[model samples]
Target: MKKIKNIRYPGKYGLLWVIALFCTGTIAFAQSGSDTTDTGMAEVSIELKYTEANNKTKILEAAVKTKVEGSWQGANGVAVQFYRNEAAPEQLLGTVTSDNNGVARMILPEGEEKNAGPEYTYIAAIKNNERFEDTEEEITVAESAFEMTLVEEDSVRQVHISLQTSDADGQEIPVGEVEVSLFVKRMFGLLPISDDPETTDENGEVMAEFPADLPGDTAGNLVIVARIEDHERFGNLEFSRKINWGIPLVIDPEKDKRQLWSSRANAPVYLIVMVNSMLVGIWGVILYIVFQTYKIVKLGRSKAAADTV
Candidate 1:
């Protein structure tokens, strides 16, 4: 009789092991490939604004940002270019680098104030960056004017505002039935002074009663602002002027005298006294312990000498 050795073939368990090894190898290969391939350029955003402030100063501001891991972050140190009107004959206004907050600004020449056409188009662009693709933002604004005046009559204060738009021929025409706003510029933001939104009449003028009790700087100078906001044709327009209209602020002479938040030279009297007392108490306890130790050593020596005698 011939002896047959036991033979075992791979069953279901062997098949599962093979499939697991294949899957692991496939996952590792895919991960390694993804590490070398380009993940594509970052998503970028640009916001452009045209502002005309005091003395007919025109400014173009571009704010740049990039989306990272589903959140928007400022793209600092990015260079941005400003252009006026169309691309073919585009007038290169200026180029500026973004600050820490991703804001780049350019001040147009004083002559730009008179270059208003039927529609003003401003473009801000970024190009040839490794991290970000070529991006641009365009904003179209119409020529608009906002004016503010201060008047005081018979113990009553008033703010007068006017809104106007320019025609194709560059002539100023009053815009009627448009909402204008009055604001007082504060440290952080604009304070609305109007109880209800005021709209312009046929003459493109609106008046609001100014409050007499608003506090101002030491010189009693307050900035009054007139704004035409989000007009379909004109976009945003603003004008401001500083005038001696607000109430004078009264500063206390002793405001900086010996307070908790003051400098060390201006430390509070009670605090100084309390700290000094604690230090004295701690030192006194230490000195008393030292004297008691000295007395014990001397008494022990005297006892030992008497015993020896």
Candidate 2:
């Protein structure tokens, strides 16, 4: 009975307990709602777009954009990284702070220089604490520049001699219907001949034959004189050089004749003589036969005259 006297009003105690439970439940619900709201916010996303405006100088222009989806928003001050496949990894191109629309624009520097083929790649990234998220885009580097080189061969004949030309750029130039001519000293004298020329083709090449009549007995040394003019273009050029036309004789006449006649039974000259003599002998035999026939006729005539007497 004494311990029961210390207990306060039961209704008051029950009211306190009910209030405490309500407060605890409200706190729990508020925390869960806050977590749901955080999840509903947008997440950070990045995109990259690029274009190759001028390929000759190896230049590229790129546009970078940052976006947010769901619940996680992009943090301030994001960085973009540009990289080439064969180059060093993860280079920071530039940095920008995201705007209210959650987009960032950036221009990346030119990538490492390369030859011929596709050369570079790009990526956009945003750093959150110690973690980073990035988006990748590829870039193509075009071929190298164009170049041309010309090489002329030694002219074998007296015709208008021309060089063989080619372009490293691989562009074909028209060469047909072009004028080609040459002037050189006469084989026997030191007279300068003019008006030798040739036109080039789409391949920057020309081959013209010279009408020089080189004698077999003269020395094979001659001066080459040439003038090349592009009738359709603005360039006119002249070239002259001394070239050796004398080629050494490879065959010995006596040796060649001996080899040629080795299989024959008679010498060529002896065969001709024998054939001529046989023809003459046949003619002589025919003459003798005619003389004998005439003599026999004369004898018969004489015998007939005696019978008549």
Candidate 3:
């Protein structure tokens, strides 16, 4: 039989390998804090971003990003709530949950915060079964002016009423469907007129018509009122103008006649004629100066020659 080499026992080496693995696992568990009690949970970090498409109107949108450690991924079912402010009647905008990537989004409407101040403060809350967290942000609404234009034409009485609507920014509010009650009686107490209720246009404009037929309405003063929805009175988003539709009426066929002479009497024609005359006069003066200078030089040369003789 061949001499057998001394061999290390397989059982002994296997026992040593098992001990090394156990020590490595214990170190990892201690460092990572893998064990958790019912009260102890890892803290989650969340970030929020806010943006608005219309700054003038009270419309806002918010996006949230949540990040929890791999160990505490089970608590991601926490409900997220979006609130306007800390008041008792704080408006709840929206709510969402974290996705696998831990992101949530919420969009807030303008009407929700109608009663809110010109400047609005927003807050977001993230809550689990018991743990809760919140963050706050502030936004402002930009005030805007109203645009008014006369939509109808009346050459006879020279009476045209224009419509005006207010907007926070450029976004036009739907005024066409809005009921606008006209208070012509209250405005012009003496004037005799029928109903003056009118609807606004998509541009938030309403055409208030002044009838040509009025009961002895000879340049009489008039008043108008506008109301929308349940609002008792129309918001003063524009300046008011007083008007008397009737005036000194004159109908002259000669005055209405189209004449070339009358058309040329405009300021533009007069300006053009003045400019052409000035240019012609300037050129004539320049030519006259050049001719005079040439004559003087020629005469001086002739005199010098005669003197030399």
Estimated TM-score for each candidate: 0.73, 0.25, 0.28
Model 1 earns a TM-score of 0.73
Runs off by more than 4 Å, candidate 3: 1-39, 55-77, 87-90, 130-309
Instruction: Report the C-alpha lDDT of model 3 over 1-309, residue by residue, as the tens digit.
Output: 111112122343555555654667766436534342222322344444443321223323333332233443433445556666641234676776655555555656656656443334555555443432233333332222233322335454322223333354534344444444443333235332336446556665555555654322334544432333222122222223344543323455675444544565443555677889999999999999999999999999999999999
- In TM-score terms, which candidate is top? 1
Question: Which 10 consecutive positions of candidate 2 have the poorest summed lDDT?
Answer: 1-10
Q: Arrange candidates by lDDT, descending.
A: 1, 3, 2
Candidate 2 residue 266 Cα shift, in angstroms, is 99
> What does the lDDT come to for candidate 1?
0.75
> Which candidate has the highest lDDT of all?
1
For residue 182, model 1's alpha carbon misses the true position, in angstroms, by: 1.8
The positional error of residue 70 in candidate 1, measured at the CA in angstroms, is 1.0
Q: How close to the true structure is residue 296 of candidate 1, measured as C-alpha lDDT?
A: 100
**Candidate 1 structure quality by residue, lDDT tens digits, 109-225:** 887746667577777888666556577777787777778888999989988888777788888898899987888899999999866678999988988889888998888999988
